[model samples]
Target: MASRRRLFILLAILALVVGIDTLERPLANPDEGRYSEISREMAASGDWITPRLNGLKYFEKPPLQYWATAVSFSLFGENEYTARFYTAFCGLLTLFATWFTMRRLTNNETALLATGVLLSSPYFMALGVIVTLDMGLTCWLTVALAGFLYAQSDGTSEPTRRRAMGVAWAGMALAVLSKGLIGIVFPAAAIFLHCLLHRDWTLLKRLAWGRGIAIFLAIAAPWFVMVSRANPEFAHFFFVHEHFERFLTTQHRRVEPAWYFVPILFFGVLPWMFTLPSVAAASWLAERERRSFPWRRFALLWAGFIFLFFSASGSKLPAYLLPVFPMLALVIGDWLARTEPRRIALYLLPVVVVIVIGLAIGWGAPERAKSAWTRDLYGTARPFIVAGGLVISLGIAGAAWLLRKGERVVPLAIVVLATLVFVDCVEDGYEMLSPRQSGRDAAAVTRQWVDPSTRIYSVNYYDQTFPFYLKREVTLVNYVDEFALGQASEPRRSLPTVAAFVEDWKRPGSAVAIMQPGLLEEVLKPAGLAMILIHADERRVVVRKP
Candidate 1:
């Protein structure tokens, strides 16, 4: 009864923390805006096979997130919340999957702790609500890893093993659909490493490879086949350009230092990060002593390999490290559940001191920042940061006190609540950075002056969020970044240079264009084109022909 009650509370907290204000926040630039707009187009066009951004073939990513968001739009009537619903749903699913997988490997307490670690981690919580394919990819990968873990259990029934294997294969297929080849590659590599480490030939026999391959092909193959058939260029663009070149070269312009993910992994698992080294060391020693493939060790390999895999790649994004979080949660959860109360108290004291100092630094940070915008943003965010720090420091203090008092589970519960508050503060404070980052308000103003029939052009700059809010496509004028492939397919739709845009503008009838502020004086004034400034913001400006 007590366990059930605790589970209910945890579920309630997860729902409240993850679901609140999901729709209230405006979609931020580049990622959230770009992805949501693709789904909006997909939902509107009713063409599920080929993903079109601004009505052009966008083969950069697979169609899984597009499909999910399109479905959400169909049912929920197309809003910010609906666009983001799928990602949040996947986040919740991952939390439950992590708990179940850990429970199978360890005890109920360990599972509960691990689930809390995942649910409350600021990075995980932030990604949970953000509209992105990474959350969906992470969820499917988690399911596959969990299912594989269950299928390999020695005492499970034959039917149960079969079902688990089926899940494992299906997850791989969906994961492929979600992102790309890395979905299958990550899990396959982990399993191979595990087998190689154990030198267990019999383990390969249990994978039921014949049925598993069929399942993977059935779900993941059809989309690739259909899309490739529909668009011949897709084969090379997706396989050669997106996957191979992206991993091997810095052509995409997302190059970073080799150790980029080192700090990301550290900060990504905040509040619990300091506990990892000791816990990881102890867990690894325990796994070695067992002399068998343990769940903890498999999770470690999963996290380690994926981290290293992306670290070696030329392209890098912070969210790409998501696959590592669940496994890290497992390691942290297992440690917290098994470690002594006094030791847990000791570990938290330093954490509290660090957080207190961080709070002081954050409160005073605005004054020291070099950029005026940064100073203003930080100044506005100071309250939330202080509040978040207090919540964490106070909660840690309470949890530490409880640990010294010999109450175990309650302390973990306290920290869970603290983490929720902490993450919430961070998210809430993020609004200060939104105005410069989001084009929603600009797009809204654009809608008032420009209509669907108006010729809208993005002049050498694209505000990815604008089209979704404006509910129409914007022509690319002398600009092609990631849209180069799409532009290649339809050269007639784009103006290749400012001179061409100027020529077209002179002959056009009632057209509006958006571009960077400096372009007006540098390009338009010199070209001698008469223009009316419709709207202007710090990042972009909208101009209309008189």
Candidate 2:
């Protein structure tokens, strides 16, 4: 009862930490603003089958997150909180799933520790609050992983095993819906590699393929069938362009070296970094004396294969490796449960060194700013950086002290609290950078001039946040980036040339165009386009037709 109470308290605290600021921060552009606007359009237009962004059909990925966020918008009304609610909700769900799965696989103590490890993971927790599909993907993948572990574990009845496998199938289906083929690919590859390594082909027979495939198809196939039927291009674009080309070629322009995720993994799993080597060693050694299933080896294979998979991919982003963290947390949590406090304390020393270095860098951040605008932004963020460093430093110190006193769980709790504080402070600091990173402020100012009939043209550049904040789409003028495919499909929606936009501007009753300051000075001004500068920022300029 006491253990359960402790778990409840921990969850409640983590929930508050993760969710308290969802509404307070502005949506950052390119990802948050992009996804939010997609959902908003879906909700307003009442078209859930075909996902569109800025009134253009966007078939780059699946629509599960858009559907979830659209539902959130319907329930809560369109706002920052609603926009991000799905991602944050998925993050919280992943936490609970980790706790539940680990408890079944190991014990209550390890379960609690695993949850803490996952929550305090900077990369994982940071992405949880941000509006992105990766967290949703991570959530469903975690569920699938947890279900697989539970299904394969010893002492499970036939019915329970079937149910667990069903959960796994459902999770993979949702994961596929959340992102793309990587959902099914990751799990299938991990399972195949695990079986090949151990020479255990019997586990494949026990996967309950008949019922599992039915559950998977029931969940994941409907959207594909419906969307492909509606738009014939979706199947080729999503499956081939998004999944295959995205992985095999650098068409997305997100190319990076193979060792990219190594540093991300090192820093991402902070406070637990020092323990990974030993934990991995222990998990590998434990595999030799395995029982019905070598779950430890399975987990290690899961993490290793994913890390290598993304590393080898043509396109790589930091958030792409999120699925690996839960398995890592499980192994680390199991190690933490068995390891002595003294050894854990030793592992924390390097974290203190890293924190101090971080503090020094934070203090000097504004000084290193390239421009006055950025300097002000860095200046605003510096205090929060210092506060976060101090909070984590104190937590680490207290945890070390508690370890010295032979207290185990309380130290982990202290670290979790400290890490949450640190993460919160960093989030607050990042929010301070929103003015430059987002179009929220610019949109707020631009909203007074915009109405249903006012033509808004985006010239030379696109601010992803404008459509969502202004509650209307902007016409693109002589610019096509990620919207290239959309532009090609709907050529009437975008102005193809500056001369065409100028002609439209001449005939326009009330119109405004947003572009970079350089575009305003170098292009529009030189072209003798008569415009009144309504608003200007370091990154953009909002000009109204005179």
Candidate 3:
């Protein structure tokens, strides 16, 4: 089993390397992109003590991710790949952690499949490369949850169980450091829901959870104390603003409908999408032998809590539901191992076909396709195009065929995974071949435009990717009227309004402007400001005021 796990670990590392950014592009996405840039800045600034958001003192999340990324950047010189290395590293770790964690609760076949589902999931793949809090949270929670699962698996021996519990608590502490209290809270919720649903309350009674709590506090408290002490406002902002307000109030206005995660949960489990049905089928198949071991029951409860918990929040992003993937993967792994080949193939065929068709259409689409969709997809790769697609398609088809043959399952998984790795590498590598703003190169270009004397402004546009890649401070233009200056972070960097900068542009010799398409027509045209569109892409609008 350990040898099998080592092989899966090797495969997981390959999957991650496939997505690792080789070219530096400007950060284009938001939230994660921007937050990562800020964290990188804080890390590089030698200001390891106080967290800053966009050059201002901002304390939204704990410093663990920032510190990690900064350390990666220090070692790697801080580009998109380096900036995202921490998140991606967490993601990779989560893959290994999930494999071992599932193995504790179930069989080896289940563990292998579960880990595969997680490694190929949409949310996990994307978050792994971007500077996102979700991946960090996912990583820590997975580690903690793995401990939790081990605790349950070792129920026979008190000493073993307690030892597992200690690991669980320490992992929980790391998870909390990754996010906040939610690290422990979410897992606790999963445990409770599992017990209640299964009438396994006796399991909880033996957990000696208080000791676990103490372990969590011990590992997590120092950072909280140091940060709070360093930044006096840390406690209130960390708890009140970031925690409660982010959840209850729409002041951030990120609220979405309750069924929001429904799609994320489905697509986020990609590559393994076909196998999910088998999990449901397997649960039913095992319904008679339903063990007190909280595998399926825990998975169901875990997924439910993550979906509904985030749904109840005042804010939502597609990636917030990443925590639910591990449980879903567990269910998937368990089912795929036990299901009949014919039954399983019936479910997987469509998913494979759709991905291929999507890839084909995306690749053939013209430069002037004019469709907003697939404009930025991985299908239009200029790198190893034929070889990559062949490998990926073969993987999917071969995996399906293996399922049809009712094989021992390891070889098919390896084949399927071999293709997935090639695809990620080829797809991500192709961006380096094209003239587009993504990954980290775009950020490097933006960095050249910035000097101490040059004032930078985005013209009604913001690319989250820009910030992370540039590794420089920038202000996102929200509503840049004259009144907007007061809301700016720095009077020079920000303003009371757009008038302050617009007025400066009139006197500029070489001050730079980043403008979106058709953006300045209404705002600046009326003021007779002639701005030049310098750089343009699906992701960014760069302008220079001559």
* TM-score of each candidate structure, all chains considered together: 0.96, 0.98, 0.82
Model 2 TM-score on a 0 to 1 scale = 0.98
List ranges where model 1 is wrong by over 4 Å: 1-4, 7-11, 14-18, 364-375
Name the lDDT value of residue 455 in candidate 2: 92
Superposition TM-score, candidate 3 onto the true structure: 0.82
Task: Give the CA lDDT, 0 to 100, for residue 184 in model 1.
Answer: 93
For TM-score, the strongest prediction is 2
- Sorted on lDDT, highest at the top, how do the candidates line up? 2, 1, 3
The Cα error of candidate 3 at residue 9, in Å, is 6.1
* Local lDDT at 113 for model 2: 85
**Candidate 1 colliding pairs:** none
Flag clash pairs in model 2.
none
Model 3 scores a C-alpha lDDT of: 0.67
Candidate 2 Cα errors over 4 Å, as ranges: 1-4, 7-11
How do the residues 1-546 of candidate 1 rate in per-residue lDDT, one tens digit apiece? 377547647655665654676445788888988999999999999999999998788999999999989999889886788878889889888988898898888777788888877865778888887887899999999999888989987687878887898899888889999999988999989888888887766777777688889999999999999999999999999999999999999998889998999877876776676787887788777777654457777888899999999999999988999978988998988988888888878877787887787677667788998768778877887888788889988988898899998877778777777877787787777776777778887887777777656888889899988888888888898888988999899888788998888888887578888999899979797878899887776678888888
Model 3 Cα lDDT, one tens digit per residue, 1-546: 677667776776666556664324345455556567766777668988776655666666777888887788778775556766777678778888888887777767787877776665655665666567888888778787777677777345877778777887887788788778788888789888767766777877766678877887888898788877876766876799788988998876677888887767765665566555556656645754665574676667777788898989988887788888877877777776766766766665676676677667656544545655335443455445556555656676676677677763564455547556655655465554344545354545656666767666654555555655555555545544321322343445554356766776777566666655566666776787876665666545666665
- Candidate of highest lDDT: 2
lDDT of 2 by residue, 1-546 (tens): 487457557655765655666446998888999999999999999998999989999998899999999999999899888888888889889989998988998888888888888877878888888888999999999899888989999999889999999999999999999999888999999999988988888889878799999999999999899999998878888888888888899988999999999989978888888888899999888779676677778888989999999999999988898899988988988888888898799898778888898788668879888989999998998888789888988888889888877878888888888888888889888888998999988888888888788999998789998889889999999887778778878899999998899899988588998999998898889989889998888999998877
